[model samples]
Target: MNQVVASAPGKLYIAGEYAVVEPGHPAILVAVDQFLTVKVSHSETVGTIHSSHYSNIPLQWRRENGKMIVDERENPFHYLLAAIDYTERYVKECKKELSIYHLGVESELDSSSGLKYGLGSSAAVTVATVRALLKYYDLDITDDLVFKLSVLAHLSVKSNGSFGDIAAATYTGWLAYSSFDREWVREKLNTHSITALIELDWPAFMVEQLSPPEELKLLIGWTGSPASTTSLVDQVRAKREAKEENYQFFLQESKSCVEKMIRAFRDKDLSAIQKEIRQNRLLLKNMSESTRVPIETSALQTLCDFAEQYNGAAKSSGAGGGDCGIALFDRKASLLDLVSKWEEHDITLLPLQVYTRS
Candidate 1:
């Protein structure tokens, strides 16, 4: 192959954050227009990796008996490296010869300052890298296989996240997701071959593409403060252990709310969808109060309040702390009024639209 390019969209959680960590719990997510793209080109002597997210200079690597050797100082591509390793391993098992290639990545998922907008850039990059490499090798690429490979590769780097972001990146649209049992996957990884593992049905994993009501419009607002999702999740986990009863109550309520929202989406009931969004926000607030995790920071609270003032339903997206908040409004609602209110509070309205994979 001369050069193959692949891209994956960033994701935002529509609802169900901490509660979705548990296996079989449901969450809503949407893939945004912002994307990370990877390009792979054939190489002869050495394979070079360049990333716009990193320094302008490229990192050079050579194969020594089928092993990649790179300078330690220029090794910021942990997720990319993992994706290459796993995909190459799968290729070897499928009786394909490995080849050297130059990999380059460029992303629009973050700010000019390289600050993340909590748009699941890591997941998008992993999916994009795998897709590009698979195409470069002239192997068949399917969304299901890409998702499975990305999950395996991502877990090898960071195992704390629920991997819902991976699903959104791979599927690329509005999604209703239930997390698979990671413990089961980890155990299976030790016992089964890569080919066998991808063929098997993962326990409790469910992903369904959703159709948003045509009358509803989704909006996103940035608080300008980046949040560590892993950190917030850890704090909530510690609190869950301490107050098991309250945590369980929150989980049950969240599952119920997400289910209703899913139904609302299917029925095209804009009213019910907005109602569930409000209920979901209050549930998250209660969880924050009980856990003391500060999921909804002051800036995020301001963003949500402004949406409510404009007759919309809003709440913090993902693990909160201070990233982005999402709101749902009727098509006829005055978006300018909401934007004006948000600007007064120094909240930036992001120009993001839902992206669906063709």
Candidate 2:
């Protein structure tokens, strides 16, 4: 093939945010309409990446001793380079010759102001790039492979993450996801065994596809301030590691709230959904106060409070220093009124819908 194009949707965690980092814990995620797209075409010269998200100048890279290398100054695109490197390594392990290709990546996952909405844009781009390269090389492009390769590439760039974003990007639509064994993966990564990692039985990591409840309205409101998930997660982790009693209590409560929310969703019980959403928000709020991690900012808390006045539910979606907060409502709720109230606080209502596999 002369060219290949692939895209992956961004994700939002409805519940079970920081707790999902623990192995065996579960989280509910939904793929949003926003997507990161990657286009790969054959190139005669060195491989380059063209992305408006990065720079006007196309970043050039080359292979040295079977490893991909880019100029030190162009480290912004390291995630893209890491995806290419991991895919190449997988191809080599299979004893197959993969042709080089130029990659063009573009994303609609950010706000008009160029601030990310914390919609897992990095994971989306990583998954899209891996899929594009696999298609370009005529390799197998199963969702399983996409998830694993994306996780590997993601870990290559950022040392620690739950990789729930990779799972959501790989499998579109609403999903109930259980955490994978990060410790096992860490051991394999420490040994630099890409082949072994690829051959592992990863299907044990559960991802059950689901659908949104009927008449349930979902809305995302951007706080106009971006949050660094890595930093927030690290802060939460440190607080937890310090054996904070309140932190432990928050984890248990949050986990139970997520379970109830998932059950309510599956049963299509709107009242139960609203109740659990409020419970989850309260748990997060208490955790924020105890840990001092700012899981819910004053702006997000006000939004949630306003949403509750209409019998709707709202809370911070991800790591939540700022970024976006998600609100869910029944058919009777007036979205226009909610939007107007949010606008008064300078919050922008994002035009996001649930994304599903075609």
Candidate 3:
């Protein structure tokens, strides 16, 4: 067995969503500090998987009797590994003998339980894992390969992904991505401008890899627990499919909001960011009656209510309906006070920074 290492970035969704799947809409994202690390250690025939791909998948599986069978009937690892293989063209290009060397893989970073913030953690892992395998085999992989492989891996794994997080994390900065190209285009953004706006009077927040820049007064709140993002997404898709409604408005508004958010980043205008997210909430709500379907369980409503009281702004961060939400505030923000409230609601608070890693 050969030892090979691979890594991928965590993600933050700035804007552009379900709409981006179409041809023109652009999805915006910023890589977060967290990451996924895969260490592909080879063995003569030793192969076992340890993962948190989903809540129920067991820890171990194997290939035997000329078939890739698993101990668990429902483990998605085989599917996950298949996506990687497809993305990296592993089965297509590798010699049959080398292919038997199952990767003793590990997804070092799991999804954040604190909030169902729809960052591209899953896709990032896929990209990194495939990248590691390609590197291990001395194969030349391109950015396009990474991006496409990531999408395939993610959609295959979760069926309810938007690819925004993966694109942002993979590029390690603000990015403008389109599903059409199946690639992430990196854009170097000046975070100082955005941070400065967020700071104005109080201490400024720094954007860097997964580390909190400093103690500040930023508030985080949630309502509903994490739910199947796919469910809500499917709802939206179904509505569009029936022609009962049009997402054009949602698409246009989301694109517009993201465009504004990027400016806010450049301008460091907390107010603008806040306002944009608020608009995003309304649009998402309109897309589907998510607010009625136990939005309270997500604590999304509670957080927004809290933010409103403090003259701050809040909205779901990832795919809405569950998981996590993002809150933005100026001098009016207070994280400490919110912690007790969030704790009372049993919601975890994770303070995250924009990715500044090179």
Candidate that would win on lDDT: 1
Best model number under TM-score: 1
Q: Which scores better on TM-score, 2 or 3?
A: 2
What lDDT score goes with residue 63 in model 2?
70
Per-residue lDDT for 20 in model 2? 79
The lDDT per prediction is 0.91, 0.82, 0.56
- Would you list the rank order by TM-score, best first? 1, 2, 3
- Candidate 3 has an lDDT of 0.56
- State the lDDT of candidate 1 residue by residue for 42-94, as single tens digits: 89999999998876889899988877888777788888888998998888888
**Model 1 residue 255 distance off true place after TM-score fit, in angstroms:** 0.9
Give the 10-residue window scoring lowest on summed lDDT in candidate 2.
Answer: 202-211
Report lDDT (Cα) of residue 170, candidate 2.
90
Put down candidate 2 lDDT per residue, 14-79, tens digits, no spaces: 888887777666778899898999999987659888998777788887776766678887668877
lDDT (0-100) at residue 349 of candidate 3?
70
**Candidate 1 backbone collisions, by pair:** none
Q: Report the lDDT tens digits of candidate 3 across residue range 211-323.
A: 22132234444343556656766666665755433566667877787667666656666666677767777776666562233332346777667666767666665565666
RMSD for each of the candidates: 1.1, 1.9, 10.0
| lDDT measured at residue 358 in model 1 versus the true structure, 0 to 100 | 84
